[model samples]
Target: MLTTTTSKINIQVRRFTIFDIENLYTYLTHLSPETKKRFGPHKFDKQSIFDFYRESDKNIGYITLDNENHSIIGYFIIKRGFLAHDRERLEGYRLTLDNQTDCTFAPSLADHWQGSGVGKLVFQFILSDLKKMKFSRIILWGGVQSDNTRAVNYYINLGFKTLGQFSHNGNNLDMIYSIDQSTGKTDGGFDQ
Candidate 1:
């Protein structure tokens, strides 16, 4: 678990639980339309929530919450080689799939929490967890929309390289991040 305080309000990072479904659902349900657009393709279906709860070789979820309120402020998922469209594009990069280290990353934060430095915090926390898990690669889920410059830029700023482009549900940019395990090195361009 990771805990941080912003102006005295504590925020924490932790794995999801069966009981968290309601809070997670509430957060997804309350996501602004604009938030959905950038992060869309992500839906609030309760079944999807259950699927995440299942946690298998295919999908996993993580979350950040205000410790006092227990409200989800950030949510992220990593899915295995399930998106056929993603696998086809990733194969071009020669990424080894169907393993522990290779997966797709999809993260979304509450609208108000975005651009407020919460993202970097969550990422730092997640990256460390990934390192401990010995993961070496992470891909953007569904690819990123060609037009969402902020999200694209955010990924790039974090050391992700644009791998290619494909039109699945829309024009998306396939990107990848390769981690150097021995040294725990990354772009680390953003401050911790």
Candidate 2:
């Protein structure tokens, strides 16, 4: 369990479970259109979320909950390997990624908590968890949209290196973050 002083909210991250269905539903459904437009890895409806929970092993889900209100404030997923599209796009950089040492990451925070520093806190927890799980790097699941300056800056600040750009549902930037165990520092810079 971890706490966020910046957000002024007592929160803890844990594996998502079946019990979280109702709260998770509320969280997903309530996302503003703008938020939804930026985060569309899958359907955000109740049935889709339920289906995701049922197939949790395919991609591990984590939820950050507010201790006081017990509502989910953040959600993330870690897939053990890269998606086919991601792999193909990354190959354009002439860098082959190893499935054993690399994984894919996707993260989303509640609308109200979007710029509250809570995302950074939760991300730190995620990095630690990934290291423990033996993953040495992470590729953004469905590259970030180029126009989302806030998210792009967050990734760059966290040391995610931009590999290239590709047009998907929109203009997207492919990025990768190598986990450095020695100093927990990343090779920071933008490739584009």
Candidate 3:
């Protein structure tokens, strides 16, 4: 578990549990249309969310909550392996995919907390955890919309590299991040 404070409120991040279903559902249900459009790896409906948890044996969900009210402020999914679509797209770009060392990452923050620095804190903890788990790289799940400047900049600021681009509803860019296990730091020029 990771804990920190932002805007004077204590926040905690940990793996999702059965107890978090309702709270998580509330959070997902309340996401704005823009957010939903940017993050559509899975359905946000109650049943779809529940089905994802039940059927996703290789995916892990992490939730960030506020200590004051225990409301979910962020949610992230770390997939153990790439999906067929992602693999195909990556292969077309000549980028190698290693199931043992590469995983898919997707993170979303509450609309209210979008630019409050909460996302960076949660991401740092995840980077460290992934390194410790022996993962050497991470790919952005479903890639990111080329026009989502904020997200594109955020990923670049976090050491992700643009491996290639593809069209998905609109133009999308596939990004990859290499984890330097030796120093527990991300290896890439995006941050430089």
Candidate 4:
């Protein structure tokens, strides 16, 4: 469990539970349209999320308020030793370690809690947890629309470098960012 003192937010990062499915679904539904279009089309219904909790619950991680509020702010799926099939793009980017240790998908705080540094705090918590898990490397990928300069700049400022850019489904061009474990830094350059 990692807590950020600066925000007065106590975050406990732990395995998912059957009880968390509904909250996860609610949170996903409340995501901004732009955020949904970028990282989503999630395949989780109540039953599916519950089943996933039973199956890979050991590896899946979630961060929630430590108080009675029990609010789920963010969640991430981490694989201790290999990238799942869904993480193939991350693998193609050559960002995984021989021991794997990669974060498949991580979504920030729900819309209401965004822009309050909750996302950065959660990310830092994940990084600290990864180090304790003996992971030598960690990486995440995000697709940014050319027009969304804010999203691109956010990733760059967070230490991600553009690996390349490609068009998907015809007109949507997406840029890939990669961070090396050794340096934990990015080049901060755009391909175009």
Candidate 5:
């Protein structure tokens, strides 16, 4: 879904399919330990990967690749519905989001690819794709860690607003990104 080239890197965002196991394995295993931690410790082997997307209707991930070599370098995972973990946190703040219109996302890039201007391109594509799907609200999956300042700042700059904090297995800050569907504008507030 990436529409423009950045830093001479042609990135393409494509929905994951069962055929992409090998590519996904290569991408996941090549990531440094820190990157993997940030992305979560999900099984990426053949069988697990296949089972993971079996219910593709509810959960989908976009694989972003450097089109030059056609290798996956990042991911944007979107899970439809108010994920149970997220629901509890939002409720703590007295905010109950709509499951039908809201979805949670976890966007991550390979260590070397991060902060290289490709993230903006990836997010641009993601926003357009989600808008087409008629998603009214977006929230970060699992919430942002209290100490992860870089990620916290990144989300804030991209129009995510903090609803409050909740201790859900860890200290996490609930964030919401609201979109004005009629005008296609995101009016999510930011921390000042």
Candidate 6:
């Protein structure tokens, strides 16, 4: 299991292992609609999610934030150094280099935790782990429906910049964002 320091709230961030895949599956399957649209169609059942750990080239890490009751209040996944081709929305922005690394996030929490600073804590943990993994840069592409102002603002606040807008379905266009880890800046005003 991976362990991370928590804030004064006493939330602990720990890495998920093969044994924890089932729990992770449960978490992912029940995420909010906004999160599902951004990172879903996970394309795997419980066994497949577990099998991924056996692959030598993949780096999968999950951090679960537990509350005083020992119940998981939040979680995040980080896949190191690979271009995710399954996400059709990112077709134009896909990384060309084999060495490029990208990150995606899915947070599962009740509405109460939305702006309680839980995301910042989880993100900071992911960033620290990425640095230790020796990745020079990381990109996170989030799709926001034009009307989803809350999500667009959330990603921007987290330091992701909008590269441009692209249509996902015939009716909704997604705002693409990119972040440069080297400078910790985004193309849009998200970094500020």
Cα lDDT of model 1 by residue, 110-138, tens digit:
98888777776677777776777777788
Regions more than 4 Å wrong, model 6: 1-8, 29-35, 41-45, 55-57, 84-111, 141-146, 170-192
Of 1 and 4, the candidate ranking higher by TM-score: 1
Q: What TM-score fits each model?
A: 0.84, 0.88, 0.91, 0.66, 0.86, 0.67
Rank by TM-score (best first): 3, 2, 5, 1, 6, 4
lDDT of 5: 0.74
Better of 2 and 4 by TM-score: 2
lDDT of 6 by residue, 10-76 (tens): 4666676777766677666666776556554234478667666666345555555555655555655
Q: Candidate 3 at 36: error in angstroms?
A: 0.8
Better of 2 and 6 by TM-score: 2
Per-candidate RMSD, Å: 3.4, 5.2, 4.2, 7.0, 4.9, 5.9
Candidate 2 clashing pairs?
Answer: none
* Residue runs of model 2 more than 4 Å from their true location after superposition: 183-192
Ranking by lDDT: 3, 2, 1, 5, 6, 4
Q: Pick the candidate with the highest TM-score.
A: 3
Best by lDDT: 3
Clash number for each model: 0, 0, 0, 0, 0, 1
